[model samples]
Target: MNQYPDPHQGEPWQQPSGGNPGWGLPPEPHTGGQLEPYGNPTGGYQPAGMGGMPEPTEPTLDTIGDIAITQNTVITPSGRFPIRGTVWTTTDMSRTEQSTPVWAIIVAILFIWTCLLSLLFLLVKDTKTTGHIQVTVQGGGHYHATQIMVSNSAYVQHVQQQVNYARSLAA
Candidate 1:
């Protein structure tokens, strides 16, 4: 003995006749669901309000000056005066173990002996020296000074002090 009535036949809410299955209400009208295009749809996707990316602007002399001082370099452009700063000094050195030229080595190996050539190579030394300096200006620019003689550590310290002074002047 079945205690529950058959679902298809006994429930008034469950109508065998075609009708609303939920809440006994007529179905909502079919409305096409598509988002409205933002900005120019033909132009492709963009933020809802903004038209497009802002245009790039040219850099001014003040901007260029700031960059020059920050990068420690001078900027020279056509129809504009070159900007520079006070000079400082540094050094570059190179040492070579094998001082003899290739031809000398070949001739020595061929005529004299490899042992004598090796001895000559050991006796001679090759050294090169180069120097640079630092130049800095107040709110204008800073750069390493070039074409200067080898500077002692004292001179370098002085230049660094000057650079610090110039940098402190910037607002």
Candidate 2:
């Protein structure tokens, strides 16, 4: 039996005109007005300028105020921690405290009164301050906490004042 010829075997395929059919015909010859790139006819989304995106700015620490308080020792089952000082900022209240062992303090006071042994304070891990004040923005459900490092009672009071000021501003 003879095989039937393929429908498209000899017909010449026509080439598509210059413009893409999906994107419509080429834009009309540029008039006096500016011509946008091929795809975007309206020229709505222009190429970014020389600077590209603006550089992100760093967050600034705003010092609202300070406070003064008596030095105290915090006793824990592990040991006693001394509060050397405190500081409060718009962000958080930080305490400068000592986490020296009682034995070490006694040895330093008695045998090493020259205070040279106090240098060992750097080795003590918990001696660093670890406190933060978290404030929730009114109506926004957003919360921000500032970690306290070296601050005094005045700083804590200042933070309270800042919180009140923020609340008043929100109102």
List the candidates' TM-scores in order. 0.21, 0.26
TM-score of 2: 0.26
- Across 77-168, the per-residue lDDT of candidate 1 in tens digits comes to 21111233343233333222335456655555675554554445434444433354434232234233323233454544554564454344
Per-residue lDDT of model 2, residues 130-166, tens digit only: 5655432312222223344434556566667755544
TM-score of 1: 0.21
What lDDT score goes with residue 12 in model 2? Answer: 19
| lDDT (Cα) of model 2 | 0.41
Residue 29, candidate 2: Cα error in Å is 47
Candidate 1 versus truth, CA RMSD in Å, comes to 21.3
Clashes of each: 7, 9
C-alpha RMSD by candidate, in order: 21.3, 21.1
